[model samples]
Target: MLQFINPLLHKVIQSISPCVLCGIDRQQHHSLCRDCWQQLPWSKSMVQRQEIDIQVACHYDYPIDRIIQKFKYEQHLHFQNLLAGALLQLRLPKIQAIVPMPISNERLVERGYNQSLVLAKMMAKALNIPIWQPITRLQQHSQKGLSRLERIDNIEQQFQINSTSKLRYRRVLILDDVVTTGSSIYALKQKLEELGCQKIYAACVASAEI
Candidate 1:
């Protein structure tokens, strides 16, 4: 009874609430009104990055880019629902679990959360799958002056297997808030492969120009 009532109550709240973007129209799609949602720089396509084809929901442009920056850096967690909704727009594959892009302990301490993990929690619940974190990320350093190869090498070293967990999933999806060069995803993928993931897939809320 509560389960049924919860959804209906949510729908009612959404119907009355103003769109997060326009702040005038009633919420329609994913906390946005019909106009705002349709205008969201949608991509809904696959992008090849580091030989991996990632499913992306939007082009990292306009309001989407700004929203992501706020959600990740500014602690505007209220935007998470809209961001998770964007990922839900993708045609995701069937996987046993979701692996959110891991952040360094240092970064987590500074930011108070791993943005990808927060989004992954929403996705895992919606998809009825477990959230898996088999990789731990070391402290991240800036790549401001590094060459491409050096940047890749630096990013690759950040991901280390979390040896404490014996649990492994043959199939999983890597969730990230954004994708640029895909260096981090590729690095993470290598680690997932080491863990014996047979069919590893990746998806992001938005993809930016490399």
Candidate 2:
């Protein structure tokens, strides 16, 4: 009789709590349940692209992409919290600052926020780093749906850093929401290098799998 009652007791507890990702019965309210958390598209290692090394938190596929769409397009801002732990879990080198890939003035006005900046700020807070915004983005068309070469062409000469900004360290980290053709970060890498930044590392929330 006691064994039969245990199953009912478990169900009662589960019903009172819900997973952040799936909304299924769970014990923690502010996080994903075990299974849902395991389903995140985690990247196993840092990847080298051209001259810069990039650290990706996860693969940009299926459920991962869906979550990004919700956060960025659907305006589900609270979902950013769902992503906090994973971002906090990422292992990054101690760097001078985390510089978020900036968006053009028009895009910022249209969207009312920069997704990359939000992710960067979350990471900076979690990692105890400062957010750097030395570079400003110029008006440009979206890079979505473009071929690799076209993406490169689209962002050419699109970023400008203030001539007066100065840094105390030689290394810096760049952050962004996504990495597709690697064009955006690569371009920023070149600019940072020109600014006397000896080494540039990058991280993004997700990336397209090869």
TM-score of each: 0.97, 0.82
Worst 10 contiguous positions by lDDT, candidate 2: 24-33
Q: Estimate the lDDT of model 2.
A: 0.76
Instruction: Give the alpha-carbon lDDT of every model.
Output: 0.95, 0.76
Residue pairs clashing in model 2 are: none
The lDDT leader among the candidates is: 1
For model 1, residues 1-210, the per-residue Cα lDDT tens digits are: 888999999999999999999899999998999999999999999999999999999999999999999999999998998999999999998899999999999999999999999999999999999999999999999988988889899999999999999999999999999999999999999999999999989999999997
Model 2: per-residue Cα lDDT at residue 31: 55
Tens-place lDDT per residue, model 2, 141-168, is: 8777978777777786798876777754
Candidate 1, run of 10 with poorest lDDT? 143-152
Candidate 2, which segments miss by more than 4 Å at Cα? 1-17, 27-30, 142-150
